[model samples]
Target: MQNLQEGERALTAAVAAAGRTRLWSHPELGLHAFVDAAGSVRLGTSDRNWAALVPLVEATATGHGRLWSGERFVETAIGDRLAYRGHETVEDGGRERTTIRLADSVTGLAADVVLETCRGAGFLRARVRLVNEGGTPLRLESVTTLTLGGIAGADDGLGGLTLHWADNDWLAECRWRRTAFRDQVVPLSRSVHGHEGRGCFERCSQGSWSTGRHLPMGALTDRDGRAWLWQIESSAGWRFETGEREGAAYVALFGPDDAHHQWHQTLAPGEEFHTVPAALVRTEAGGLDAAFGELTDYRRDIRREHPDHRTLPVIYNDYMNTLMGDPTTRKLLPLIEAAGAAGAEVFVIDAGWYDDDAQGWWDAVGAWEPARGRFPGGIQEVLDAIRGHGMTPGLWLEPEVVGVRSPLARTLPPEAFFRRGGIRVTEHGRHHLDLRHPAARAHLDSVVDRLAGEWGVGYLKLDYNINIGPGTENGPESPGSGLLGHHRAHLDWMASVLDRHPGLVLENCGSGGLRMDYAQLTVAQLQSTSDQQDLLRYPPIAAAAATAVTPEQAAVWAYPQPGHTLDEIAFTLAGALLGRVHLSGFLDRMNDDQFALVRSALRLYKDIRPEIAGARPFWPLGLPGWDDAWIAQGLRGRHSTFVTVWRRGPADGTSCELTLPHLRGARLQPSVLHPTASDSTAEWDATEAKLTVFLPRPDTAVLLRLR
Candidate 1:
């Protein structure tokens, strides 16, 4: 083994800056972080080291960032005010780890900054742990997981840096945009005072929908072409911001704060609380793509080892198209038989099975037991039918909420549900469960165990549709704090369940991508990207999903219905080609021609699905627009590259050209992988490094595999 020099790599720390600070080096990516004697953190890339000391700390307050802190400020980890306590370095499985402890000089509060760098992953994982060192309890507002100071440096200013973030909505997720700091320029003259950031760039996700409004992730590219990508891997409420302080640039991220979700906690003496982990990747020569690609690798590394990561099975759910929540034993038998014949490995029976009331099933949920009135013979018959077709049986469950009119809603104690001002919080005909309460966890665990243990259930589509705004102010310091506790409890419960039932598959669906965060992605088998019935609007969402999620775990709906031409059917199926193939619609009603096209797409998906696990995403037309006439997305694997193009609306001609940057000079054979209702053509322009596709009309798509 070779002994590397101090402060060269592997998160080695050493004295620097005339003994004023300690420098920690990230070897694989060549990024350096400095902790001053005052415990202020700073960052510098290999391309450019800093000349002025930058303060690496951010908190929810009125003085920093653009967002308001809800008129409450608990100043703890906010600037150079914290004192450097001590640190420890350890090694595990050839990976180096460092945990640096910092404390508030005025108060009996302290925090630990955890840093981990692997051998060759070219990324670092950072998280913070808050501790109360006082004899009395201490109140806490919010703290950042990781803060990078000197993003652009004091002398140079933020003019050289570009800020990048993604806007994620329900149906249209992972829409990324880049902006230069100079564009939103807020000039601060050094002649008057020191550098102070103005007009800070800020973003946040409210409520339980972690990705509802915007992704808790962003990136900064410096003038020297070096880029840094940072993501807060939390499923609950989170926020991140970029701002200029003096001539330097700073970035701060936190899980939850009082301003957004009314969250604050009083830490008891000797108690500790840890925030969610954040990932940062620095690229030496490449820009955003290079940094983002490294982030993709980091995302894969954080995911738990599971069978879904390997098998990449095709799933069939009878919710969007076929059943539409009117499930019966009679109706499910044929769909089950047909889906199995179509080669779907998992068969999920969607909602409407738990209803016995004549009104509807929406308000009669929470009692997960199947309604004998609807099934006539027993729900077991349908389960057996699914198994008889050689497919795994799955069920849809909304375990976190109790319908307003449900019997359990009236029976369970009010403490089990989220409450504000001594009353239970209700939204959209439902009451949100506070998983921190023992009763709530017990009820949910009972429901899950009954379904999985007794009924032979293998897969679960966990769906959350409602959001209790702000948070639950049951008995915590604030509503946001209570919600954060519930969120942590929920994750712990999920980990326990998965540990107990390793083979069980959990599908995450929060009104489709609304609650799609890394915390859920680590536990859930797959995520349903959207429930957009409009196939036309789904292409952009499906195409851009790879920016925030792995294509392998992303499930896009492909519902081929009757009265559809072969081209139209292929278009719908192609929407799900690059991601998970969630086959839908009334397959029992399709003719031989229509059914053949459906099966063909599934077959093609199975062939390319394995590559998706190891593939890297590239968009030729740039991050897709909501109403673009043409869109192209590509996935480049080790051996072959798969590209899908959509000619959605009116176009000038029968052909359009797309550039594949990864295969610019390589000789490749291009083939139209899917035979649609109409004839298609693909021509490779070697000199231009573009592929020209010939299509007959609008509302059509095709998959081209370049080998």
Candidate 2:
């Protein structure tokens, strides 16, 4: 390894001799990278403070080098021996992409590290492309999409850093945990040991549910309020780790690997593979909220353009706490009428619309046709009724699985389904489809075309319920690599569907938020946040959903029952006002007053949705806790700021104050924007930049506008 002075002199000489250097900096993106003559790269926010840095490409392959290799995914001999080839940049619109190329002389392995950023943005998107140039096959164990180091301050090394990550599961999703960096990665006294630590704090996904265990997002914040927020965009397997390195802190994000997801790849000569994308945002002072806000902007830019994001039509699905998959014509017509009357723009007949057997639809699902026994007059009758009420008709379909007993399971070729050791894979009575196969892709394409094109359905709710363990085995490919291939093929199929029917809307749901990741969100128009039935338990998920998804795409259910009090109805409705409204429950049985309350909330949401499309999210009271008594979330727009505060349990205090540093010392008038007839009151204190909201009763929430 070259010393700092020697590396600088080499860079200067290279630049002066051939107009090339080992240092590359992008002023517009605030990105600084150092690639030594040996092809070793180090990335950070600044250039002057680079020291004892980790390599940009941390990879391990079969018959490769591992210096003190143990559990950590770093310090590989191949990453250190690669020689720098060249780099090029391309500018398109306001975004610029730079590709740094490198290759290993010993193994004939090559890599292209692609980095992209928008002009005037504080974030960077990175991915790697690998090719095998040697005659022999190379089996790769693990590869990093992005690695960033030099995270500590000049005075405080790792003492002032705090680690933040979110825990996700069925119903209980987006529960964040924050701890001191030292707690997870304790001091090892490397000065005396004469070596770096072998362990680090790591989080990874399991099975098919990308977010079943933990969200693919995490952060590190300093005492000075600076933060680095990052997310790995993969619908397959993903892992991220942060630990103390050379007295500082470093984070490495990856997509599937042998140790984590049973994923590996054997590349033949001239074959190439591209890893999933990952992003990182650096905020100098505003902490997590500011970093998330920047990430939100980046998400909006990466998504496929669709009108559904801007319109944000209120969708009423008869599934959660309502029809519960038994959607008959007798049960759906009334609800469709009530939903349309309550201001729903789209009505979805969820789940059991296809069951004809008395046994159940769970294990007999593949055929998406309407059931004659349930619909009697045919499912078209219910869809017609929805359209008559001026709403877009939709149907729920899980296209990735076929019930083990379904006729298609036997008819389709065995290769169309996921298989290992010449046996088909089954999970929860359903067989997973391998979309990479032509027959599987053809079957789904036919189903979607029949519903969205022939039937004139304007929306389709795509749900994935089962976790099919690791993945299918395709010859020499590992299960993890097969899973990655299937996921990418699924994404391509969805994009093709949209290309055929440009006006249609697709809702991404994985037994409600389990498959929540940007790789799916970028293609789908909406994401179901959760399937929690209790209204009190949903505020935390709703408040913190924007950390993983954009505001317009995060769909929250608002199911107000006929038996609830007026306040209870308001509570549920207000939670969905900031996000895409997923209305359910027995609206047909609600009294005139209850129906009017639902209508009024939807009307208010419609009026404010335009601002929401462009607003940046903020946590006035910080990110919400699972059991917090008082939860607050705000969206800062160009013209005004909107805040939603929820108070739960037996409140000891009737009011709580939310600090808004941006509005401090500015003249403002704040007012409650929802439940015009409620006891909720809000007062703005311009002097302190705080909004004190009073909801006299428990389990109540209010949305306030400060301008």
Candidate 3:
């Protein structure tokens, strides 16, 4: 034991020395390895590996005799560190001998490794640069591997969780299986599933068979596919899986197979891409959510630095229904008033604010004018009405589209619009504005600036109805014509607009849920789940919202439509409570019963808004194959809790049972707040292993106060 301790000390000293040397001499190079004070060794570097490997391949081609490069060593007080950062000139028989340069603006040296204490979590972040450094186009097929330390004889409890691979259109064509070193390989070909329209692949295995587990991590392409590899592991007590992507380049605290999240990038010759993978390590205490919260908070800080940061939640109202009928400010004012009375934070006037001409929806899109016949006084009247109701006013705009018949169409040249066969084509009722053009960007900036700076609008709902063609006039070119880069540029333009209008809240909508990715979510606070507004549709919508994003980020809208009833409306409103609620129903058309229920729900939501905002929810019932009854609990602090229950269909004359987890050691008292019950309150001890509570029919909710 003494000798082992001495050996560990020596290892730690050596790692520390290596870290110090790398940090000093070549702070920006390949495969840097270092050790922190906690004795965890970290190896990482900026995408330099692609460049480093290029020289080796070239040497092999040139038939160089065992092409070798000298290593440079640096000395520190603890130990010595060695690094190699030069080109290998090689010669292979009958192959062209090539000397590959190790450095280029995009293909060269990048910060590759970080081994340090990040926010109190001992972690190792490995980054590698993937550069197209060779004359012949190259593709990357790499896998990230990690070997567990101090677990040679001990068992790593990866068995408790499951592994899920995110499904993608690209990954669907391939067939694969998960194989264990000592155990049977699990065939997961059909096991892969899709959620919220994205792909999710899953498998479960026990880590007790061996101290190490190898996961299939490389992109299965012979030539043209490249991907950055990410791997994370935590102390066994956590509930989340070891291999999963949660829509971002990270894992979730809930479970591995729960969802797949990743950021994808395609690189062209002489072009490079960069991404950050944040890791959190909990020493047998916190879960993935706790770690994610740290990253979320960091992102929030970055968002706050932007000039336009909206603090209040915004909802979609009125304009979506305009497609069915003429939506005038007078028709929308009452609904806005009711929504305000019902505790709506912001009211957005959706599409149809402008008049369409022969040129299509594009003509009126960039022009921020209300239809003269619909609103003689213009949009300011609607803004005033919303503001009068004590709610922030938001307006929808599709600056990226232009109607050919619009007044600006004659003013702007045809070259400003995206064209097909020399004619501006219409898509989804609008013509795409060439956002890739500098003049078009300037026009959009001016349009947004006028609304935010001049019109006093506090919020803007930007909509994109169709996908714009990747700015390549020719067919697919190398580096892929900067499709994502142009989209990112458009995003930057929007961010700049927000920077100019600091108070404006931007809600992104791509015909609803199409652009619901991390890039858009990072800039926009809320996203529309779907265009549908029926109350019954809220369950699947809310479930999808829960799966893809946090409840706070979802913007769920509901309207009465044709078949929805008052009771159904209230129950549907209850579903919206699980997320950020948006109202679009005709408030004036509702009877007294509907009004009263809306008032009650609004009061209840306002009462526990903070709890709803901060609490972590557990879906005890709803969707997941359970009946029409649904139960969700929001727990805040240690003693305060809020619970919502909904009984759909006829309720079957039988009460549903609800069991509360994580509520031990407290006295929980639940009460029915709606539908007038004789015995409203029930007291029980929460310390029991499980407590089953009966839920009445037609959707019932109980608030539990712990003392």
Best by TM-score, which number? 2
Off by over 4 Å in 2: 1-22, 47-51
Q: What tens digits encode model 3's per-residue C-alpha lDDT throughout 370-409?
A: 6777777777888888889888888788766776456666
Using Cα atoms with residue i matched to residue i, what is each candidate's TM-score against the true structure? Answer: 0.92, 0.97, 0.64
Error of 1 at 341 (Å): 1.7
Local lDDT at 245 for model 2: 76
- Compared with the true structure, the alpha-carbon lDDT of candidate 1 equals 0.77
What is the alpha-carbon lDDT of model 2 when measured against the actual structure? 0.89
Cα RMSDs of all predictions? 3.6, 3.5, 13.3
Model 3 residue 405 lDDT score: 55
Model 1 C-alpha lDDT per residue in residues 1-707, reported as the tens digit of each score = 33323433322233323334545677776666666433455655521444343444444322233232222222233444665556666776767777766676555667778887777788888888888786877666667787665566223667778878888886777777788776654676755764343346778888878888887788888767687788888877788776654456666777887667677667798988788888888776657666767777777877878888878888999989678988998888889988998889999988887878787778768979898987998999999998899999999999888988898998999899988888899888899998988988999888888888889999999998888877787764477777777888888888777887888888899888888788888778788788788888988888988777888888899999887887779999998888888888888888999998888888888888888898888787777888888888888788898989898878778788887766788787798888644488888977789899888789999999998
Please list the C-alpha lDDT of all candidates, in the order they appear. Answer: 0.77, 0.89, 0.43
True-structure Cα RMSD, model 2:
3.5
Task: Answer with 2 or 3, whichever has the higher lDDT.
Answer: 2
Models ranked on TM-score: 2, 1, 3
